[model samples]
Structure formats: structure tokens, C-alpha cells
Target: MSENRKKNSALKVILIIILVVGLAVAWIGYRAFIASSIATSEEYFYVHTDEPYESVIKRIEDEGIVKNPSYFNYVARAMDLQTGIKPGRYKLSKDLSNRRFIGNLRGGYQEAVPFRFQNLRLKENFAGALGKNFEADSTTFLNLLNNEALAEKYGFNKDNFFLMFIPNTYEIYWNTKPEEIIDRFSKEYAKFWNADRKAKAAALNMTPEEVSVLASIVKGEALHVDEMPEIAGLYINRLKRGMLLQADPTVIFANNDFTIRRVLNRHLTIDNPYNTYRYKGLPPGPIMMPSIASIDAVLNYNQHEYIYMCAKDDFSGYHNFAKTVAEHQVNARKFQQALDARNIKK
Candidate 1:
């Protein structure tokens, strides 16, 4: 009986050790599963140029894409990945291991797509267009360009600073902030305005603002690039002679509608700062987004004594230069005849 009791006691001790070991192993496995789940969860992530660690964590949490935001923050900080995450939209899974998550975040696993801008003009319009391609509010994007502080820094007044933003195709990451994009474009604009252009503008008694305004008018008026210098020359002559620019583009701008078949005599009487016909100078601002060709045309326009030009009837994509009102009237009549004959629906 004593031998049987001792054997029973030995068996009890062995069973207790096995049970403890099994519980410990199970606990470790469960912990590992939780950690892996948090790492791989389907969460939206983002990073920016100067995003703080707390903000990044909170942003991900607020997005409701993660199951455990704190876990992600802790793991990321532990692995020294607090600042390594790139700026872009990321797709994450809930079942990702911590190692895999960090690897993907820091390893540049995703190729960022690019967004572009082309021929943008109005501040609000530009903002709305950019908003369609990026993750920013349109109003905020516009207010920056219209900001007085940035304008003063860029050597332009509020009314004319918008022209400094040239309309060109710019490549940026798809998720780029509106502010960064604006900064990049503004920097490029500053580079474009060199000392030589500045000297030329000063010589013409025109500010950079006036040059850009004229360039935009020339861009919108002449369909052919070769005609730009001639158009510029005509406007420059008018400015020199104290004559009304009387540019039809200005009338179109004042009207806020560009599809006019022909400018009626009454359209010239519109009371707007942009109507060069009424205002004896250049428009208040640029009428359209001018290209580099147009800007160069204004900068290098040939000095001419002539004060008028009318479209040639030859359909040769050139204009008839007139030195007198009589000659200009004749050329204008000729152009009208050609339009009538071609049944050109303007």
C-alpha cells in the first residue's frame, strides 16, 4: 500500500509539470498571433516631409483602418522606423507580421504614381483641378497662391503673382500635399525670372507683371507662335503712343466668356479693369496661362514704329502690318472679307 501511494504521488508531480509547460507555450503562441495580426492589418497609412510621430499614429488610428494603432506605433518606434516611412498612400493588411510591415514601409515597396499640371490659370480653378488629382482641399490650395506673404517673398504683388506660376506639366507623387506642390512650382517660377529678364522689364517701363500680362494676351490672340513677336510689337507701339490697346482679348476677358464670334461695338464699353479698350493700359492681370514661347516673345519683341496689325487674307498664318489708321482700316476690311467668304463661324 505504501509503494502504491508513492507511485501515485510521483505521477501527480509529472502531470503538473506537463500542464505548466503546455500553458506557457500556449501563452507565447497567443501573444505572437496578436502581434502579427496588428502588424498586418488593413490600415491606411501616410507620411509627409515633416510629419510628427504622434500625428502619424493618430492619423492612422482616426482613419479606422487599423485594429491596434498603438501597437503599430510601438513596433515602428522599436525598430527605428519612426522617420523612415515615405510620403504616399499605403495599403496594409491586418495579418502582417511586424517584421514584414516595417520592411514594406521602409523598403520602398510601393512605386508612387505621378500627378501633372497643364495650362492652369485662375487660383480657384487651379486648386479644384489639383484637388481632383491629389489629397487636399481646393480652397486651401487656392488661398496659398493668393496669399500676400508668399507674393511679397516672390517679388510680385498679389494681383500679378498668379502669373509667376507658369502652366506646365509638373510631375509629383500622387499623394503630394498642395502646399509642397505650390512651393515646387513657385521655386521653378523664380528660377525662370533671371536678371536679364528683370533688366529687360525695367527698360520697357513695365514690371514683370505687365510683361506677363502682355504675354498672356499674345498667347490667347495669336493662334500661330510665329505671329507672337508681331503681335507684341503692335501692343508695344500702342503703349508707346498712348493709344488704347483695344485688344479684343481684353474684351473677351471682361465678358468672362471666350466663345464670342465677334466683338460687337458695345462690348468695348464694358466697365472692367481688364477691358483695355476702356482702360488706357494693359489689363489688370494676365488673361490666360501663357507658355514659354509667349513669355519669350514679350521679352524679345522687335522694336517697331508701326502701331497696327490685321489678319492677312492670304491665310498664310501671318498679319498685315500697318503704320497708319488708313492702312489698318483697309487691312481690317480685307480680313472681314476673307471671313465672310470662308463662312468662318467665329
Candidate 2:
């Protein structure tokens, strides 16, 4: 009975030891694989190209991307996460498991940023916008824009290169090269010029780029979307008649002083090609990023005899149209008088 009692005591001790060991193993497994690895609610992190695995791990730890980075390191090694890691922008959430976090990093599960642009007036402005949203440098974008070889390769000259960027939201990898971004824009530009749009441009006896330039003028002239077609027609008439565009917006752009409320005589005399008042027909390129509506308005221009327009005297953001110079002068006088009354000196 004594020996049996001793045997039962030994068995109990062994069973207790096993139970404690199993629980410890379970706890370790949970911490290493099942527990939430991300400390924050959310985080966006970047792994640079050719970055060492040690550096990547350090970034995760230093950036507070994980609740228990040591546990992450353990699971990461177990899954061989370092073997296939690639550079990208990745998102981490508290909901992510250690395994998932490591697995995602290994498989290059990345997030694409939405790049949006519209109504940007200058190439430099667009460069800043690109720099704000991507890993690309502003200087790189500017250099590409100024490169004649690049522009020619893309069916554009340096002057008209800005027209290639049709303003809209585009999903792109954050690490996309600046040149690759230009490629994406070229593709989007092609897509925007469908057969129907090309046919319309052809019927108007203008290239797509020319239409966009005219659209920019139409955009600048009217404050209302409804007025674009009529204003476009008036400009079309001037073009057909081989008259100078004499656009106030072009003069403002050439002067590079957007604060001018009233275009004065001095502003029109700037020896710049963009000064439409000094040059015949359209400017070299768009003075602003033309909206889709403005482009379509030019394509479907209103058939009218009016070749002149001036802002209405009431400042209603509409225009008074006229065919004869005498009538235009009368409209211009009323608008000029209104400007004088408002004290909008430029």
C-alpha cells in the first residue's frame, strides 16, 4: 500500500508538470502567432528598395508598428519572411495577426495611393502635387517635363507636355518612378481620347491638344459651366477669322501675376508667346488645367454669329455677345464702367 501510494504521488507530480508545460507552450504560441501584432489602430509604413531585412525590422520596431515586435521577429523567422520581402507601402492594423503581418510583408501585399489632380495652372504646381502624393521627387518630374527627348518620345513637345495630364484620380503604387508616372499619364490620355472624342476634334479642325488650350481659355472666361459653349463658339469664330485671340486669361498667365482683376494695357504687351493678345490664334499650351466639361464644350461649340464677348455689366458672371466691333465696344464700355465703379484696379 505504501509503494502504491508513492507511485500515485509520482504520477500526480508528472501529470501536473505536463499540464503546466502545455499551458506555457500554448501561451507562447498565442503570443507568437495568434495575438494582434500591430500596436496602433493603423499605420502606413514604407520599405525602401533593396533595404536590408534587419533595417526593415528596425523600422517596424522603431515606428511602433507592432505591439510585440520581438514576437513578430520570431514568427517572421519561422515563416521565412526575410526571404521574399520587397519594397512597398504597407498598412498595418491592430486586427492583423503576427502570421498575417509577416506573410503579407513576405508576399509584397502593398497599398496604392490615389493621386488626384485638377485645375493646376503650371507644370511646377503639378510637380508639387505629385511630390505631395508620391515618393517621387518634384525635381525629377520637372526635369522630365523639360526633357525634349522624353517629350518627343511621348508624342509631345516640351511646350505642350502639360496637356498630357488629364486631371482625375489615378491609383498608383507609391514607389512608382517619375518616368513611369508619365507613362501612366500617357495611357490615360490615350484612353480619354476615344474614337468619338477624336472624331469630334477632327470635325472641329483642331488637334486634341489645341482643343484643350482653347478649353482652358473658355474655362477662364466664364464662371458658369453653362456659358462655356457660347464662349467657345465666340473664340472659334475669332480663330476662323484669323484674328488674335486677345484672351485676358493668357495675358494674366504670361504676366505670371494671377492677382490682376482687370487686364491693363501693359499686361497685354508682354513679349511672351502665351500672351494671346500679342500673338495670333491659341497660346502654345493651356493656361490652366482644362476641365472635362470645358473640353467637351469646345468640341460641341454652339453655332453662332457672335465673335465677341464681354462680362455683363451687372457682374452676373455671364457675358454679352456681339458680332460687330461697334456692338463689342458698347458691351466693353459697360463692363469697364462697372469695373471702375467697383474700384477693381489692376
Candidate 3:
């Protein structure tokens, strides 16, 4: 009987050891599964394209994005983070769990980035802004813009290429290729010129691109949003009358001088085709990107007999419209006198 008791006691000891080991492992597995892996101060984590998986792990550690790097590594191994390295900008919270974080990285779950270019003045500036919002280098996009074949592929020349853009933002992946972005914009541009907008452009005896060019002038000249249609109407009237646009904004654009508080006679003397005061009809292309409102204003311009416009002497950002050169000259002289009174000579 004593021998039996000793054997049973030994068996119980082995059982207790096994139970303790199992519990310890369960605690570790639970901790690894539920632990807060992302302790990052940043709202998003970036992984670059073609980056090695090991380098990504190191970046997570170096950036202090994980609470415990070892726990994250163990979970990553379970979720196969090393096998697939998806490059993207992922939205991460401060307290992301190891399981969820690893799953996001492994499954290529990324947040779409927004890029609005409505207000960018120059193509170079637009390309630079794109670089800031995406992974591709700024020059990559600029090169595509400057490429003649690529521009022709989209049915535009370098001069009229700016018309392809809608100036509104769409969902873009952070790591999208430059060529892919241009294609996407081209598709969006096609969609934007639907039958309705096309009919409007046709009714005005203008193509979509021509309307965009005139809209850019309207956008540049009108300071207030309410005055956009009026300005567009005035330009359209001039186009119908076969008169020189004589837009001061075009003169400034031709001279590449934005600091010119006033367009001078010397400014209008530039030989560039963009100088509307010297050239007839539209310039080579749009001087700046026109917003949707500005574009629509040109499509739905106010019809009136007014052939000229001058800024109000009251400095209220409103324009005084006139039907004849005599009335226009009077308005222009008042505005010139107002500028002299304020000493706004450039």
C-alpha cells in the first residue's frame, strides 16, 4: 500500500508540472495575441515599395510603433508578415493590437489618401504638391507631364495638357505609379465631360478645352465668386465679337510676374503668345487651373450686351460693365485714378 501511494504521488507531481507549463504558455499566447502593438505617436505608418520585410520590421521598431517589438515579431510570424510586404500608408491607432496590426500589414489594408489640386497655379507646383502627398518623386510626375508622347496619349499637347485635370480630388493610393495616376486622371476627365456639360459647351460654340481656357481667365480675373459668371460673359462676348481679350491677368501670366499690382504698358508688350492684350482669342492654353465653379461659370455665362469690364473704384472686388468704349474708358479712368490715389503702382 505504501509503494502504491508513492507511485500515485509521483504521477500527481508530473501532472502538476504539465498543468503549470500549459498555463504559462496560455498566458504568453494570450499576451501575444491581445497586447497593444502600436504605441506610435503618429497617426499613420508608411511602408515604402520594394522594401524588404526585415527592413519593415526594423522600421516599426525604430519608429517606436510597437509596444513590444518581440511580441509584434512573434505575431507577425504567425500572420506571415514576412512573406508579403505591401507598401502603403496605413492608418494606425495608438493602441492597435498585435493581431489586428499584423493582419492589416499582411493583408495590404491601406488608407486612401486625398490630393486636391484646385488651387495650384503652375504645373511644376502641381507636380511638387503631388510628390508631397504620394510616394513617387516630384520629378517623376513632372517628367510625365513634360513627355510629348505621354501627353499625346491623353489627346493633349504640352500646351493644352492642363485641360485634362478636373482640379478635384479623388481617392488615390499613396504608392500609385505616376503613369497610373495620369491614366486615372484621364478617365476621370472623360467622365467629367458628360453629355450635359458637352451640350453646354456646344451651345456656346466652344469645345470643352476652350471653355476651360476661358474659365481660367475668368478665375484669374474675378476675386469674388459671385462675379465669376459676369467676367465669363464679358470674355465670351469679346470672343463672339472677335475682339482682343486684353486680359490683364494674361499679361501678368505672360510676364511670369505675380507681384505686378497693376498691369503696365510694358507688361502688355511681351511677345509671348499668352499675352492676350497682344494676341487674339485664347492663349496657348490655360494660365492656371480652373476650379469646377469657374468652369461651370463659363458654360453658363450671363448673356448681356456688355462688352467691357473694369474693377470698381470702391475696391469692393466688384466690376463695372459697359456697352461702349466711351463708357468703358470712363470706368477705366476712374479705376486708374483710384489706383493712383492708393499708390498701387508696381
Candidate 4:
């Protein structure tokens, strides 16, 4: 009976050893799984449209954010992530588990890209800037801007469709469609033209487009915001008197040569309708994308009898205004002498 007790005791020792070993192995396995299942780096992973599971796996491997790509692939397959792939920009962190990463991918949680633009000179430049901020390319954006049908559907034509985009920062998804961008701008434009602004436009006897056109000219003329109101007033005076605007900026625009430092009699002879000296009234479209301040300057123009302006001889970006041609010529002569001293003849 003592021998039998000894054997049973030995068997119990063997069982304990096996149990301890099993626990140790289980612990080690759990640690390895946990270590490999979480993102090892903080970065973003983008999944584009029509990308397959293999492509996504390759991209993650290329990014080197996952601790173990093979293990991540196993976990992704086990969770059936392949069947629920979503397209968007996904931000990953070191603490994010493989399960959570896959969940985020399947849920379509994306980061919004911030897009801001101001003082853009041309539609092409605007398109290029917008393309840099979003997934769409410049050509695609330009095509949409030039699409007559699309522009007409949004209550604008290709020539004036650019007026819809207000200069501001907007939070939009990176994958936002071009049409959606235009629609957003249209909505913002409508909101901007509220009752007060509409009343101000009416008081000036100008439509929103006309105001924008004049504002563009004002923006081109005055570098200082404080000077915009006076310049706008001077232009308004010319309009009221049925006199040719003869704005040098309009002549430069008509020539399509922004490099011209001085507008000469030759530049004034340009046959374009934008040539205010050759053709009276506002231009057919804005010369550049006008700022909100310039637009408001036109809406709240200063009352004055001045009908002519010449750039100040001081090179201070301010203009000298006059009601009579003699006074304008005097101001013009001062500016001309300054230009000649600076050797700026074009």
C-alpha cells in the first residue's frame, strides 16, 4: 500500500508539471498575439476605390506600420475584412488593434481634408490649387468648371461659374466629387447673397455679378483694403456720368499681359471688351477672383465726386482722385514722372 501511494504521488507531480508548462505556453502565445495584433506605428492608411484585399495588405506592408504583416493578414482574413472593404483615408495609431483597424476600414470613417484658397488669378490656377488640396486633378476640375451644361444647371454659365466659389477655408472629404464641390460653392454663394447684401447691391444699382466684376477691378488697382472703397467710389462716379472707365488695370487685363508695369496708349487700344478705356461699363467677367473685402467695398462705396484716379506717385499703392481732367492730368504727370524715374516703361 505504501508503494502504491508513492506511485500516485509521482503521477500527481507529473500532472502538475504538464499543467504549468501548458499555462506558460499559453501565456507566451497570448503575448505574441497581442504584440503583433496592434499597429506598431502611428500613420495613416489610404484605401482607394476598387482596391482588392491583396492591394490593401501590400500597402500596409509598404507603410511598415503593422508589427507583423503576416499575422495582420491572418487576422484580417479571420475577421472577413475582405468582404467589407471601404474606400477612404484612415488614420492609424500604435494603440489600434488589428480588429479595430479592420473595423475602421469597414465602417468608412475618413478624415476631412482642409481646403483654403484666396487671391487666385485665373480659373486654371484655381483648379490647380483645388486639385492640390483634394484627390481630383486639375484637368478634371477645369473640365467641370468649363462644362456649360453643368454650369447652367447650377444657375451660372462657364464664363461666370467661377463667381460661385467664395474665398474661404472649407472642410471637405478628400474623395469628394467635383460636382459636389461646385454644389457646395453654389450653396455658399446663395447664403452669402442674403437680404442685407441683396439690398446693398440694389442700392448700388448693380447685380451681384456686376459688383464682383467691379470688385475685381478694384482689387487689381488698390493693394490696400482701405483704398478699395475710394477706388470703387471713383469707378461708380464714372459709371454714373456715362464716362469711359479708362482703368489701367482693365487695359492690362485686355492685353492679357500682367507683366505690364505701365499701361500705355498702345495697351488701351486692345479691342477686348474688358478694355474699359475702349469699351465703357464693367467687364464681361472678373479679371481675377475678387476678395470678400473688395466686394463689400463696392457694396459700401464711399460717396465722392471723384471720377478719375491715378496711382499715387509715392508708390504707396494709394491712388489720387480728381473730379476734373486738369487735376487728373496733374496727378497723372506726377505718377508718370515717378514711373520714368523708376525706369518702368512698358
Candidate whose TM-score is highest: 3
Candidate 2, which ten residues in sequence have the lowest lDDT sum? 36-45
RMSD of each: 7.4, 1.9, 2.0, 3.4
Q: TM-scores of the models, in the given order? A: 0.67, 0.93, 0.94, 0.87
lDDT tens digits, residue span 1-346, model 3: 9999999999999999999999999988877888666777798998999999989999899999888888888988888888876899999986678898878777889998987777767889888988899999899988888888988998889998987988887899999988899999999999999999999999998899999999999999988888899899999999999999999889998999989988888888999999998899999899998889999999988988888999999999899999999999999999999999999988
Per residue, candidate 2 scores C-alpha lDDT tens digits across 1-346 of 9999999999999999999999999999998899877886556778787889999999888878888888888898999988988878888776788898777788889889888888788889999898787787788888888888998998888888888888899999988888899999999999999999999999989999999999998988879999999999999999999999888999999999999999999888899999988899888888988988899999999999998888999999999999999999999999999999999888
Q: What lDDT score belongs to each candidate, Candidate 1 first?
A: 0.75, 0.89, 0.89, 0.85
The parts of candidate 1 lying over 4 Å away from their true place are 1-104, 107-116, 148-150, 314-317, 341-346
lDDT of 1 by residue, 1-346 (tens): 9999999999999999899999987765444334554533444455655667667667766866445655556566777777687556555665665556666667655435455554665667777877776667788777887888877776776777778777666666656776777778778887888899889888889987789899988887787888898789889989988999988888988988768756778788899998988899887778877778888888889878778887689887688889999999999999888888988755
**Mind giving the per-residue lDDT tens digits that candidate 4 earns over 50-80?**
7887888897888787877776777678778
In candidate 4, which residue pairs clash? none
Q: After superposition, how far is residue 77 of candidate 3 from its true place, in Å?
A: 2.0
